[model samples]
Target: MIGLVLAAGAGRRLRPYTDTLPKALVPIDAETTVLDLTLANYAEVGITEVAIVVGYAAETVASRVKGFEERYGVHLELVHNDKAETWNNAYSLWCARDLLTNGVMLANGDTVHPASVQHTLLDARGDGRQIVLALDTVKKLADEEMKVIWSESAGIERITKLMDPASATGEYIGVTLIEPTAAADLTDALRVTWERDPHLYYEDGYQVLVDKGFRIDVAPIGTVDWVEIDNHDDLDRAREIVCPS
Candidate 1:
């Protein structure tokens, strides 16, 4: 299967650091950055076809990954999203819809996780489920993290996007495995949401799919080493969890 990395965001929360370079290219530990760690994990899972959607400072992000294209035997396809400044991640995923067909692993560029986690998720996809959203029970979910209220009886029957801090139940660890049919449904829903709210998040589209009686399997990652770097503090936390200074 192929891997799609959504790296088109401007990372406004990252401030001065992202002002000069894309968050994917920001150095973490040793010499690896967010994108480097993510690509390496994908390669380890035997996903050699990688598509990266780039936006702000695309050239620099592309340059950072050039070496890995040959080194890891991954065929890297870079798709540019010119409207990244105005659009959200839902748009970035839509941009790579063609590649996402035939089932693919989708991830955010700034998330760092173990290669084994990806393998585990893929192993769970044999039943032809429409969508599988990776989730983890976080001890303390911040207000900004995406949270979901899933039902074990019906799988991920419903997902609440950008859940309020006070109402959050569990955290959605930004990795998803989706079937082509589900991807198409999500893409269509995204179009509708975008027409009404240009800055709509990808989760908003997923919620629509849930409302349509589409079953999304919730795969709980459970107490794993994963990090989503959005700010300077997160960078430090990532270093500690992923590589450690």
Candidate 2:
């Protein structure tokens, strides 16, 4: 399976560090940045063909990726998202539609989790579902993170609630395994939504799919070591999880 890393965001939440460097390139541990750590994680699972969708500070990201490829002997494909500023992550996914046709492992660039990924892939492979989104049961659900409510028996995941920390049933772990057929449908839905409502976030597309009666299975990565680095505090927490010095 091919890997798609959505690294196109400007990371306004992580500014002024991101003012000069992209969020993906921000140093996390002693030497590895978020992007490098993520790539290394993928490499560990034998996912060598990687496509990173880049935006704000795309050149710097590209340069860093090149260095990583040379050092790790991995193939990294860099795709640019020109409309990254105006569009949401759906646009970044759309940019790599061609590569994601069969079955692609989609990951958020800022997420650092290597262990859960293998379990996620196994879950996706065992079930013949169209989309499989990784989820975790966190003690404190933050308001900024996406929340999911799913049917345990049917494995039907629905974004029934948005950024409601109190109403959240579970936390989305920023990793998804998607079938090409469902991804194509999602792409079409995303395009329609963008044309109708340009300000909609990517989770809106998940809502659309759920509303359309599509079965999106939830692969629970229960209590796994995972981190989504959105702000400075999150980065610190991730460092503790990944480096632990």
Compose the digit string of candidate 1's lDDT tens values, residues 75-157.
89899888888888877777787776767888898888887668768878867687888887665776677888777776764
What C-alpha lDDT does candidate 1 achieve relative to the native structure? 0.79
Candidate 2 local lDDT, residue 80: 89
Task: Give the per-residue Cα lDDT of candidate 1 at 220.
Answer: 73
Name the runs in model 2 displaced over 4 angstroms: 160-167
- For model 2 the TM-score comes to 0.91
Q: Could you tell me how far off, in angstroms, the CA of residue 107 lies in candidate 2 after the best superposition?
A: 0.7
Candidate 2's displacement at residue 57, Å, is: 0.5
Candidate 2: residue 224 lDDT (0-100): 77
- What is the Å distance of residue 206 in model 1 from its true position? 0.4
Clashing pairs in 1: none
Candidate 1 ranges beyond 4 A from true positions:
161-169
Task: List model 2 lDDT by residue over 164-240, tens digit each.
Answer: 67766688788888877786788877777677676676667777877787778877776777778889899888888
Which candidate achieves the best lDDT against the true structure?
1
